[model samples]
Target: MTQTYSTDWDIEKYRDDTEPEEHWELRKAFMEAHKGNFSEEYLVALARTFTNIEFMGCSYPAAVMRRIAELSKDVAKTYRENKKTKLQRTFVSASNAAENKIKKRQSDPGVLPAARN
Candidate 1:
């Protein structure tokens, strides 16, 4: 039997195997290096790093992840505002649901207190 692999497959496999920590380091370095000149490659790489970290179920600080999520949501909102597509509308709806859940959790009270003697 013969084994063959495409270059694209190899690249993807390599990326999939890359450590999230390394990706995060690279993203940080890129941001610091290109602070004012944000290139498409840097943005894409950062997004990929975040996706990889999310997919691998890596442990990150809740505050950091929440901030990342908030930034992503803001970008999505901007995209939706610019595009005004049905898909974007759906995304907005889903975002509303998520926000509602968060709000409800925050507003919800636990068990009621019993009457004082």
Candidate 2:
């Protein structure tokens, strides 16, 4: 008699077992072997790989992970700066409108605050 197994279950087990497990070790070895002669392409690729592995809940060396985190933070800083510029422009426009309203009030002496009495 032959036993039948679910295709989905088999595929899931294959994926879990076949997924790359040596990414961090390989990356660490590469960096160590080429410490002083690191290239930009290598750094970018390493950082991207490290980031991906981290997102996948894999473990990596602290120092190497820190470097990758720093690069990621730099990217985040650039994004925040761009966002801040847009927000600043919006605030300036609003400030100008408020100033204009105050000027109009000041120029028209007929507009006055309610008396306390």
How would you encode candidate 2's per-residue C-alpha lDDT over 48-117 as one tens digit per residue?
Answer: 4653654355556898677766655543444346656663433458889888877887777675656211
Compare the candidates by lDDT and give the number of the best one: 2
Residue-level lDDT tens digits of model 1 in 13-97:
3333445765544444433433333344544455554554544545467875785565455333443365455342234588898
lDDT of each: 0.47, 0.49
Model 1, TM vs. native: 0.24
Superposed model 1: Cα runs more than 4 Å off: 1-38, 61-64, 74-117
TM value for model 2 = 0.27
Off by over 4 Å in 2: 1-41, 76-117
Q: How far is candidate 1 from the true structure (C-alpha RMSD, Å)?
A: 15.9
Model 1 misses residue 52 by how many Å? 1.7
Give the local distance difference test score of model 1.
0.47
